[model samples]
Target: MTDIATKPDSIIAVERWNTFWGARDLEGMKTVAADDFIQWHATVRKNLTKDEEFDMLVEALKVMQITFKNICLTPMNNDTVLQQCVADIAIEGAGTRNDVPFAMVFHTRGQKITKCEEYMDGMSLPPIEFTPQD
Candidate 1:
């Protein structure tokens, strides 16, 4: 496994994270995230720690059968990166699927992400036609 911290640019860390998720490699997540990483998700309405966030994401990946496409990654500065992507979520229980567009901002210190904030349409949960099965 390549060490995430060895990368000279913060954007590389974000790219590595994308690759890990695309491959569904849970162990690779540890390399790109700081031990104390925090994630603030708009849909969740709460801040989650590194483990909590990844655990929840893993569950979502299974139940939602998520697939990502049309991703746009930008390096805003040395410490920040921005991402825009479309996520297709399968809600088999609701007998529906939704294509949602979302944006995220990643804050990095060195090559590990320290914080992440995600923005999407929602009130309490995602503002989509299908209800979350979980």
Candidate 2:
């Protein structure tokens, strides 16, 4: 079995999860999530399984056309990473654009992410419409 950190799989998984704006490869996103992974969505105002949260994110992305463009990552020891991202987010139907700042802490076991805690400005960016796709 190949390890996640030193291998390509880990890198890909991290990208999919951390940069999960809308255009990220969703199929690829599955590889990094643990079977019972739990994610707390700051924007959603809920705590859900990885699968559940991912679906919500994707739906919002489709209608919103948002993306996290320039992201800076900082390694906080081997098991954790601190990230700051500036997203060029747009609401497709509304024809609006927002430059949002977000921060998250990632905890990885080997290559797979086990826990992710995200923080963002609630006042600047209101909760996005996360209704699932029909």
Best by TM-score: 1
- The CA lDDT of each predicted structure is 0.75, 0.65
53-104, model 2: which lDDT tens digit per residue?
6787677657766566567766666667777886666676555556688787
Q: Which 10 successive residues of model 1 have the least lDDT summed?
A: 124-133
Off by over 4 Å in 2: 1-13, 16-23, 131-134
Model 1 per-residue lDDT tens digits across residues 46-134:
78888888877766655566567888877786589998998776644644345688898999987788988988775423343322223
TM-score of each: 0.78, 0.73
The superposed Cα distance between candidate 1 and the true structure at residue 52, in angstroms, equals 1.1
